[model samples]
Each structure stands twice: as C-alpha cells, then as structure tokens.
Target: MSFLPPWVGLLLALLLFGALAAWVLRRGLARQAANLAQVVTGEDVQAQAHRRIQQQHLADLDRALTEGRLNANQHAAARDELMRQVLLDQAQAGTALQRGGDGVTGPVRWGWIVLLLGALSGLSYLQLGAQQTWWPVPLSQRVQISATSPEQLAEQTRVWQQATQNRPDDAEAWLTLARLQAAQNAHAQAEQALARVLALSPEPDLWIERAQMKALSAGGVYTGEPWQWIENVLREQPRHLNALVLAGSAAWSEKRHAAAQSYWQRALGLVPADSEAAQGLQQALAQAQAASPAAELAQGVAAPPSAAAPGTALAGDARPVIQGEVRLSPELQKHIVTGATLFVYALAEEGSRRPVAIWRSTPTSWPVRFALSDSMGMGAPPVLSSLAQVRLVARISQTGSAQKQAGDLQVELPGVKTGVQGVVLDITGR
Candidate 1:
C-alpha cells in the first residue's frame, strides 16, 4: 500500500467503502424480506382458522332451524344474528393478528436505520476526511490556481473573493483567496483576506505570508511595519524557510548585503545542494560576495604563468575552458564607487571583439573567482567550445557598457590557450 501511488490508494479505499455500503444495504433488504415472510405466514394461518369457524357456525344455525325448534321468523332472525356475530368475530381476530404480525415496525425500523447510517456516514466523512476536497474534482475543472497565467489568476481571484465573501468564517478558503489575490498583485485585498484568516486562526505562517503581501504592496521593499511581522515569526521559528528567503531578498534589495548574506546562507543550508532553490541561493551568494570590498591579499598580484596544455581540455569543457580570478587594484578601488558594475568575460584570441562567455558582478570584495564555460556561452556561433585559445578581460564599467569608454578601467590576459589554471587578471590605476 505504501508503495502504491496516492491515486491508486485513494481508488482502492473508495472501492472498499462501496463494498461495505452495499453489504449493509443488502443486509437491510434481507431483514425487510424476512419481515414480509412473517406477515405472509401469519395472515395465511389466521385466514384459514376464520374460514373453518365460519363454516361451523353456519352449520349449527341450519341444524337448529331444521330440528323445528323455532318458527320461520325467529329462525331467520337468529340465523341472521349468528352470521353477523361470526363475521364480527373474524374481523376482530384479523385486526389482532395483523397488529401481532409486527408488519408496520419493519418499514419503520428500516427507515430509522437508514437515516442513522446516512447521518453517521456523512458526519464521519465531514469530520475525518477532506470534506468537499475529499471528493475528486473533474480533471478539466481542477486547474491549480497557482500554476495559472496572470490573466487566469486574475479571473480566479475574483471568483475566490466572491466565494470567501459568502463563506466569511472559512479560514482555509480565505487563505486560498489571499494567495490568488497576491498572485494577481492585488496585495491590499490579499492582506485583508489574510487578516480574516488570522482572526479565525492566528498562525505563524499566516503572519509571515501577510508580511510578504505587505512587502509586495510596497514594491518589494521589506522594511517598516511589514518587517515587524516577519521578524516576529523569525523570532519564534528561526529556521522558517519562507521568512528567511523573504528577509534575504528584502535586504538584498536594500543593499544591506551583509544581512542578506546571513539570511540566505542560513536558508542555503536548509535545502538540498542540487535543488533549484539551492542553485538560486548560490547565485545570490556570489552576487553578495562580488558586492563586498576587495580583500587586501588580491591587490597588485602578478598573473600566473599560462598553464594551457596543448591537448588538455578547457578547464573541464571538452573544448576550451578559461578559469581565473578578477580583482580591482587597491589604488583603483579608491576611485571606483561601491556599487559600480563589473563585467568579466572571455573573447576569441583573434577576430571580432565579441565575447564567448560573460559574467557581470558588482564587487564589494576583490579577486572574485570566475569560470567561463559552454554553459555561460552567449550569442550564435563561435561558442566557447569552438575556441582553441581565448583572451580573458575584466572591465569596471561605471556606465555599464560592454564597449570601451573613457572612464572604464580594463585589464586583459591575451594569448591564453584552453584548459589554463591559476590565471589572474588584475585591474590597475595605470
């Protein structure tokens, strides 16, 4: 059973329940059949006895009149009276036998049993099962609202809002409505729905969710009143993943790189290394590190000798792979602004100045390690994999331009062949 798919388990459970219900119905029907048999048997015996007694009474009346014990008028009157009495006695006996047969009780008892069974089944299912959700919705109508397009979600939000209005006390329904509203960027309305949920059942996750809604309403800002709610949840459950992610994003947006790093690093530890969430966090961490101030050790270091082996595969690429560290000179760092964009890339050793692979960073720290491989390759043709040799370049482009400009500080490592190691490019004040 544990190995079976969830839907299969559900199907088997439904079949079992149906069989039980059928057995119960069959048993009730059999009891009714037994009651019918009792009624038939008793009625048959009573009718036979009544018929025999009636015949005997007629005979006795005929014998008396024949023996000449009375005149015609008296005999006729007595015979009429005897016949009337006999018929009265038979009707009284039949009424008694019918009552004694317990015929009415059968249907009445069955009716009560049926009602009880129905009520019990309904109540049990409502209490223990998924309630309305327990029943399978038709496949065509069961589109998950979360996965729907923005337009579809907008329509769904209206429908869900109307439903929640009709069922004001339904906490789960309100929560669902809140999510749909938020998805459609109706943050204010979503917050109101979340308030209703909290009123019904105050939960930590709800608080965090409401805070997130508030943040979205403020155009991705995570500070002010909303942060209070988020902070409260974090205080209670420090390892809460959603709260951590929200906090990190908010900090990053605010340029509070250190705080963002703390929150995101914690979250990174909570997820699997290969998961998408982990990958996203890794990217975030890399950005955070780049935004940090360059370390002293990376200042003014000479480039490592080119270690490109003649037949060696690019760092790890089947073709050319260029791996190195890019750093701004300490003297240059004094002139550059904290958040200036840095572009580090590799180009063909000869030909047009188009890049094979590129990475952009805003460095707060120096000597940021970089790897250029096929995965990071851009544009059509002359890919990193096709290059036998390449030139690596790093540019601190205050204007965020790829082409060289007057104010840009640039450095290049030329004639570096594929599969090089310990290659370093340093930007200088020269």
Candidate 2:
C-alpha cells in the first residue's frame, strides 16, 4: 500500500467514497420505501397550510377578535383557520386557475430544480450522517434502545425492591425505593413506596419527590396534586427549597399560574441566583411572564431544629401553561413571551373551590386557544360568562403557611373585550 503514489491513493479513496455514497443512498431509499405507509397515514397540516393562504383566511378571525366576536383566548386561537385556504381559493378562483393553467414555463422548471436541490441536500446528509456516531449507543439499536433503557433501569429497581423487602422497617430504604420507582416511571410503585416511607416519618426529600412525581407527566402536569403534597411538607417546614420549586412547578402545571409564579419567585429568593435549580426556576418564571406577566413572594423561615427538613427545598419548575381570556393585548404580546407555561382547569362545579378538573403544563405546553375552545362543554366545567364578578388570590405556600399574597387575578381582565375561552392554556415565558 505504501508503494502507491499520492495520486493513486487519492483515486482509490474517491472510488471507495463514491461506492460508499451509492450504498448509503440505496439504504436511505429503502428506509423511505418502508416508511411510505406510515407517511401516507399521518396528518400533513404543514403541506395543507402551504397550499392555502394563511394571512387572508385568518383576516376574519382577526377582525372578529378585534371587534369582540371572540374573547382573548378565542381570538388567540383564531377559529375558522382550518378553512383559510378554502376561503382564499374561492376568493381568487378565476385568477389563480388562469395563472396555474399558464404554467410550465422557464420559472416553473427552475422551481422544480430548486426543490430537487433541497431534496438532494437532505438525502446527502441522511446518507453521510449514518456514519456519524454522536451517541454512545450502537447505531443499529439506537432507535429501539434508549441510553436509559427500561431493562437497564429495571435491574437497579429490583435491587431497590429487594432492599425494601429485606428491611421492611427501614424508612431510608423505603424512601430510596420510592425515588427509584419514580425515576423508573413506575408511578404506582413509587406512590406505594412513598406511602410506606411516609408511614415511617415525614421525609422532606420524599415529600418533595412525591411532589416532583405529581408535577411530572404521570400526575398530569399542573394537576396541583403535587402542591397538596408540598403543602403538607411546607406546613411543617417553610423553607423547604425542593418543596418550593416542586410547589411552583406543580402549581403551574395545575393551571394555578399565579401560585406557580409566587412559589418559584420565592424559591429563587431563598435559592442562590446562580444555582442550577434557581436558574431553572428563573427560566420558568421568564416563560411564565412571556405567556403572562404573573406574580408572588414570602419571607424565608428556618424550620425548627427537631424538624426533618432537608434544609434545602429544591423542586424543578412545572412552568404554568396559561389558557383563558386574552387579558393582555397585542401590544402586550410583545411583552408576553413566545415561551409558555400555562395550564387551565375548570372547577368540578361552578364556583367550586375544589379543582377536581385540571389541565397540565409541561415541556410541550401549547397555547390554550383552539384545543380548549370546545372543551368548555367538558366534564364539570366552570360556566364563565363575560363580566363575571369575582376576586381571586394566588397563594404561595411554604411549610403550610399558605395565603401569603404572591399574586392576584380578577375574574375579568379589565377593559379588554375578550372573555375567557378554555384550552389547555400554556402560561409561558422564562
């Protein structure tokens, strides 16, 4: 091999590269053929939108919203958007059809060529990228097996279960098992472990963990159930930072935006501004503000010496996803965030203090415009009409000293014409 000239080596290398490229392209085409069936069955909203006019069709909706045909949330949702293309097509039927009939010219050919180039670029990346191994997992099984695979997790879980089984009376083991189960997404098992651990004693971390689980996807993000758990812990230990963050995220996930804001804001105060948890909390706060400028805060109180406080109340953010009337105007939209952390819930009964019904905010919190527009008729919803007189306070709790005024909201977002419309609202910002 060393005897070959540099030009010969280059030639051989280019040949192999060409062959490898052809081989990779063939493999990609095969994958595309296999995925054709799935692609056919999937929704193509983007393609559909591309075919129609977005701006014109949304005009009526925009006008209606401005003229008070819909509320803020409703206006934000922009109803009849599904028919925008239809409306645009009908409006310009003759002209568009005539132009399309006169097509097949130089520009048309150039357009297809441009499209082809884009497709080729994507194909080239897909062909060449197969060899790039950014992940530690083997390429073949990467899709099927996650870095944190369930089987790998179950193995550790078994050891945790065994520890609890062998030492049934050990609170610490029970606590450890509860944490493991939650990590494993074994929610039922985690709850059981937490119950046993709670029977032993009030472990702040365990309660925080329990609250964290509730804030997680399983508890239906923002269900406020985590808040209840954290509330209990906060009742005994006001400065529990985990409880604070969990309480903030849980409250936010549960659609209690103001409560979430207050808890997280207070948690930031107690937490060092530069800490990981606090930074996360700040992001959550910023996201909340973006979705809606919401508020709360309370003084830090050290728990009693005998108390089982972890001394650090740290909880991850469950950034509230807000959905309701557009309390803030379009001018406010600038100040309002593209980031969302909103969740909206209806009372089990009209004016019912208990929030049996809930909407959750998570990493994927969507704007509560369209989805909840029709959910108003859903199970035990609040009958909110325009000009409903009500005053609400957002309470941020620490060790159970709740009702510390962290935030407030009026039933009506004064002066704005839109009324509240339900959606899985995201109150996002930070």
TM-score of each: 0.37, 0.34
RMSD in angstroms between candidate 2 and the native structure over all alpha carbons: 35.7
Cα lDDT of model 1 overall?
A: 0.66
lDDT of 1 at 158: 77
- The sequence of per-residue lDDT tens digits that candidate 2 reaches over residues 175-292 is 6666556544445566677778768765566666665544443434434566577788888888877777667655544445567677778878897778765666666666444433
Using TM-score as the measure, which candidate wins? 1
Give the runs in model 1 whose Cα sits over 4 Å from its true position.
Answer: 1-147, 294-430
